[model samples]
Target: MSARSQRPGFGWAAPATVFFVAFGILPIAIVAYLSLTRWNGLGSPEWAGLENWRALPDDPDALNGIKVTFLLTLLCWLIQTPVSLLLGVWSAGRQRSRAILSTVFFLPLLLSTTAIALTWLSFLDPNFGLAASLGGSSLLSSPHQALYAVAFVIAWQFVPFHTLLYQAAARQIPTSMYEDAELAGANTLRQFFAITLPQLRNTIIASSVLIVVGSLTYFESILLLTGGGPGTATRVLPLHMYIKGFVGFDMGFASALAVLLVAVGTLLSVLIVRSTGYYRMASDREGFL
Candidate 1:
């Protein structure tokens, strides 16, 4: 048969491609051009050479922001993933509990980030707050622990999403695998390792990537919690860029920070996909043995 006959028309794909180019590719090009220039968010963007990038390291607060951003991303993902997986597997096996637990976990995600941030801000406040009511010190005041507070809030918001993804993957597994495991006298733990996990590899990888992206881009949540901190302690890259661009009125520098944030996010996404063997799992119909 002819190639034209075999490979059909654009149809729906054409619109999607157009959308991608219009919204994605075009914006990226604009941002790329803006990053290399000095702009006040107004007049012409004058080429500033590598001035913005070179100044990044010397900006003490910005450097600290970058460090905290990476730390928070790692902490949130590490803590959230395993809990989500275990709960996902358990809840997927039960109907009523799954429904109730999924609702509970997803409720926070349904709320606006600004609302969640405000709620968390009060909860972590030193006075007249839930944390204080629980006889705990003010999380917002404690620079050492402020980032963890942000992580906790984010985890609480997103764990349900990860669990739902995991459950969906778990439910797709064949019942014969569980039956065979029982027949072989393999305990629940062994059965999970041998059957469930291997099958859920793709789901796990996908969930991790999603979580990483969420943690990286989180702004309002962190902003409200501590306003980037008592002393810039919890200022992450997004917050940093916001402050520099809007608050500091340094559009060029802000764009540079934005570029770095995107670069880091892209790099982490690549690493997560490769490390989790997402590609291999996707191509395999039966999952890993």
Candidate 2:
């Protein structure tokens, strides 16, 4: 083909490419630029060199927020991912069962974060909530337990989404593989480890990426639940940024925190992509048994 004729279609791609460059790339570049300056969202922005990065280490609130953010992220991932996958596998094992169970699992994702938070507020009410009504202590009212309460709510809310993802991935496994494994005298557990799990590795990794990022950045659930209160026990980075920017009106430092958030999120996504072999051209079915 002639070089001129070899050009690809730009009809739909052009607009999307432009949109990304304008809204996504440009904004990220601007944020990177702003991160190095001392602009309080007014007047001229003064150059601050590495001051923000330097301050990040010593800022107690930022440090705490980072700790809380990672803690919450880790808890959600460690607990939710496996549960979702197992549920998905169990649900997908049968057609009718899958429909009913999947619906129940996914119901939480349909509710607004605020609505979910408020609903949990009542459930976790120390005085008269369902917890107390059921003769159990309300998890929300206890500072020692509030973080776990929020984490539980978050995991409960997102489990269905992950379950659905895993279900879809699991359903793609050829029945022949299961039959072959069974013929080899492999039991369910053996088939799962040697056959099923390895097949779903990519989907599992992809789902995990979504879960981790969602848990890290999503604060509405935690915000309404505890407002990062009980003495900053749950003041995650996003909450800290909100308090600093809007409550404290220190736009410069807030923006710096925002930049830090973006940096951390970006780094996390990159790490997941790298560790999961997600960015490569490998097919999802490449390693399947």
Residue lDDT tens for model 1, 191-226: 999998888878877888888887788898877788
> Global CA lDDT of candidate 2, please?
0.83
Question: lDDT for each of the candidates?
Answer: 0.84, 0.83
| Tens-digit per-residue lDDT, 115-224, candidate 2 | 99999888888787888888777677676777888889988888888888888888998888899888889999999998779888888889888978887787888889
**For model 1, which pairs clash?**
none
TM-score of each: 0.91, 0.88
Off by over 4 Å in 2: 1-12, 36-54, 284-288
Choose the strongest candidate by TM-score: 1
